[model samples]
Target: MYDTLKDTYQLFEEIGRGRFGTILRAFCPVSAESVAVKIIDKSLLTDETDRACLEKEPKIMTLLSPHPNILKIHNVFETEDSMAMVLELCEPETLYDKIAHRPLPEPEAAGLMKQLLGAIAHCHRMGVVHRDLKPENVLFDSRNNLKLADFGSAEWSGEGGSMEGVVGTPYYVAPEVLMGRLYNEKVDVWSAGVMLYIMLGGIPPFYGETATEIFEAVLRGNLRFPPKVFRGVSPAAKDLLRKMMCRDVSRRLSAEQALRHPWILSGGEANPMD
Candidate 1:
């Protein structure tokens, strides 16, 4: 079905490479604009899990897309030997690239977090769960506007809602996910919390040398804010982080609730982002 993708999209430069495929910056001569394309070799799709994971992506994006901060898909198709997805060309950078060097100005960080939360709220409202939420998966366009990308780990929440799957980056995985219990979109909130912790402190709240050790530390749910580390961070910021980073999924703030948190909505009148 997508055989023409080869003739339609002319690869320009490689943008990224992942476990499953190569992402390239390509131009579709017919459209006269650049877009990102993920070309998946047929050999990988034959594996049941790989195909199962990616097959739903096009449909999911179609169902819950068009949110300003959620990555948008232009087209998706498969041919006899490969599958491809043409997507919006976000800047070849991620949230991590920005903050990993130094934290953004606090108010600016708050505004950016607000955008991220808004995107996640949109996903939950549509009954879609972004099983993976981390800085590496969040992108920024040329305007510095945020867009959530990498939906390969995303899943649709059906009527029953709760799902069981040990997925997501180790440092950001929620307590329930680490415990092997049924989980929901709240896991994304927890992961977002971990990302927040990193953005502010320049380190994850829980850390260990190995994944197993890290999982154990995460399960303990011990959080720390040494004065030197969080000195300039506002109390309201800490308050929201604690709530979002809560261990009990039931107690954690939902995405909508989080958006309304004081730190986000009350960052000050002079704030241009408000």
Candidate 2:
């Protein structure tokens, strides 16, 4: 653990600001490589629980680093005042940026979803639940490969078990979570489903001006693909989305199961619904 960031890496311009820290583009002389360093100020974490969660972020990334779709952490440094994580550098554009311009074509959306599901499956198999899954958490690398970033809300599920917590963003959170019920890794599938919807429709399935309204819309579980937005989407693609966003947790498809869906397996070549 270095006492400060400047002692080890050459920090550059701030590339991004996160919930508790700023991400800087950094260069490591020893490796002769560039990386993104997330530097968190310990003083900002006044709540003990928040600090504990922050401490776990890098550990979770380390535990799940083997998967190509997951962001890789190169090093972790900590001091009394700061926690810095050196991570694999990627393209600055996030999935959120891409979708904001317009919805992706079916083939492109399918390709991205496959990679996202693969990452989620790997996390689930490791007994880890990424409670927070959103477009902002998805990054693109230099080669345009999708990478799952940000594990601040992740939790270990204890050997294929379930966990209870009302954690997750309002737009993509599973209905079970809002109900304060014990939930499993399938919650990620729900969030991924929301991403899929946005990729194809350019808007989330649930809508509200406020968090409470969004939560209510989620609990209502009224899933529909507006013809104006979904006209060109394949039937198989819509089928997969329905299964993933299914309100009944028992019926929702797991990430592994979603990988096998016809739309994904066929790479979005499935016939579109007329």
Candidate 3:
């Protein structure tokens, strides 16, 4: 099976590795283009539920295909030994890399958030929820535009527009999720809020020495912005953050609502110095 794929694509150069498998930057001779191949070992699929989840990924990708901010899958191939998914090649760095040291300016952060919201909004529009929406899962292109990747944890909204389960990274999980409450696409909204906070403050709104402490803070969701840190930030930017991080599910802004926020509408362009 690997040989068959080799006939079409020249797989080389390891780019990323994870528990199940590794990602390699490969080239297609026929298309004369470069692509990323996520090869997962079939042996890891021994668990019935695990195999089901992996199978669901291709379906979810098809549901949101061609969206500007969602990563695109060119093809999927399952072989006797492994599963290969061919995806568009995004630039190497991610949001996690860009703001690793300090937060970006309000205007800059808004610009990026707008793109992020747009992507998630598209997914929600299609009734899909990206269970894991963290900076590490978001990749940027050469142009710095954001692309939401890794639908591995994604699931359909299902009946009633909500889902049940405890999934997602600790820091970004919605408070409701932490409470073991039912959730929907709005969970992604919470993640975007956490991301917005990190972008502007250079740290997550809820943080603790351990994952449990972090979970406790998220459940509390009693977050605040220190004036000294946000001193020069614009009012509209702060307002949007407040709206986004609202703990109440009903009060929290949806992806579409977030996009319409004044700060986002302004393109996050008003420099703080003004």
lDDT of 3 by residue, 205-262 (tens): 8989999999999888888888877776777777887888788888989999999887
In candidate 1 the C-alpha lDDT for residue 2 amounts to 50
Please list the residue runs of candidate 3 whose C-alpha ends up more than 4 Å from where it truly belongs after superposition: 271-274
Q: Write the per-residue lDDT of candidate 1 for residues 102-138, one digit (tens) a residue.
A: 8566677787889999999999999989988999999
Say which candidate scores most in lDDT.
Answer: 2
- Ranking according to lDDT, highest score first: 2, 3, 1
Best by TM-score: 2
Candidate 1 residue 57 C-alpha distance from true site, Å: 1.5
Per-model lDDT = 0.84, 0.91, 0.86
Please give each candidate's TM-score. 0.93, 0.96, 0.95
Q: How close is candidate 2 to the true structure, as a TM-score?
A: 0.96
> Among all windows of ten consecutive residues in candidate 1, which has the lowest summed lDDT?
265-274
